[model samples]
Target: MKKDENLKKVAIAAPQLHRHKVKLKIGNWKKHFDFNYVNTIIALALNDFDDKIFFYINGYLITSNNLYLVVQTTEKSAEEMVTKIENQIINLLKTNPQKLKENRSEVSIIADDENLFYAARKPLFKIYPLENDHLIKLITGQKVTLPYFDRDLEHLKNRIRNHPFCSAINYLGGIGPVKVTLFKDQIDPEI
Candidate 1:
């Protein structure tokens, strides 16, 4: 596990700027990444347990083959968080056996507390969709947005639409990345 070494390198280069995220590598289940089913199941479970979830960064690959979730809390460790996530996923499978088949996974703590993998890049340039039109600024000067990928909304509308319960997000500034949760309704129908 070179995770500690990688974090050390990142720390020396970008002190105090980091993201606490988990990279879930699931094998043999890429076909289950469907929005109508798989993605929705994950979203609903996370939404149901919202207090523990910090951000829904994205799917690791364009093929929707991996899950990139950002979460931070002093109450739990990386292993604990992964255990909870795995438990949620197992619960999902137990409740809906037809959603997906058997699978294997490897979860790791990929970065600093607030710095997601995206902002971890040397020069960040990806546009994150805010849950709503409302944008925010951290104590440092940076923009943060929680991209809302709604199903029924138009491409443009979906970009602006947020979850019914939450609409607030912070901009990605020198502080790295902030927590942007996925609302139960944020699943993309077209995904």
Candidate 2:
């Protein structure tokens, strides 16, 4: 089956996990705390899913749906942060065994602004293996260019129509400059 098809099955067949939504106010220097907290919460909530939680930080919509859980943080002490994150992850593993057996893939992390200072501070840098090498090469191989919003719209439409999995999306009721949309299908429309 196609990747999208398999993911759709996983979404539909996998047991729905309890989700926690946290809104935290932090000073600029403490921004790192936000990533750490979010990761910890996801890890705790989905402990059975092989203790794997995908993270995304200010991620843009893209065709490749494989790397959905990618995040960037501002913590400087990588060694310490990785240990803590891993410990929380272990706690999740001990809590959920069945889900772990079903989903053992690594979590994806997408950094929102490519902030070098923040990137350097992430604990994942010190612990989890990085898998963005190919993506980095693909990006570096291309000539840097400005984004075309119109072109992106077309690409998004094509992806939504041709994706192999069915998707259910939820979005803010009204239209505005910024909107929030949730996807429960193979391809998230509002990603």
Candidate 3:
């Protein structure tokens, strides 16, 4: 086999995890949350990718519908995917089929492999193991009074800062588990 042909084969055989996080936020609703409309929007966004991508969607109900989505496609850059999705969402909103003229939505790329690396380096929060003394105090019902309380709190804070990585992620939402593929090493051992 020719050297160039061999290289092409190797590249084709390798797994490509081109993961991207897209956040979709819809705002300005006077009445109820329209779950159907949001669902339709998500479906429409994914339609462009067809079967070329693997994706997970997590929806948050705040003042508006906040969707955090992770899409992995072997063939396209994150930017291309985001642009397509943004255009689809904007066009749909412009139609205003629901007659909610005031309603507006925004779609953005939150992270790709590169920036997610930097984000992983930062600690969301840290956990410190409870000391034997603290456990004993809690078990014995020590008086919850000033100096001891203040000292314990300060001590706990110090431990967390000193050993930030001792803590692992407590929860993994929809994107959390699958999106970890973008940075496998960032996954904490404890989790």
lDDT of each: 0.35, 0.30, 0.36
- On lDDT, the stronger of 1 and 2 is 1
Over the stretch 93-164, how does candidate 3's per-residue lDDT look in tens digits? 444434332234733332232332233221211222222343222212222235435776556445423421
The TM-score of predicted model 1 comes to 0.36
Q: What would the per-residue lDDT of candidate 2 be over residues 49-94, giving only the tens digit for each residue?
A: 2224332122211222121222223334334334444455434433
Q: Which candidate has the highest TM-score of all?
A: 1
lDDT of 1: 0.35
- The stretch of ten residues in a row with the least summed lDDT in candidate 2 is 165-174
Task: Decide which is better by lDDT, 1 or 3.
Answer: 3
Off by over 4 Å in 3: 1-15, 27-35, 52-63, 75-78, 91-96, 102-191
How many clashes does each candidate structure show, in the order listed?
A: 17, 15, 0
- As a TM-score, model 2 comes out at 0.24
lDDT (10s digit) by residue, model 1, range 29-118: 334334345555454555444543443432211113334444434434455545555566555554554423223353333223232222
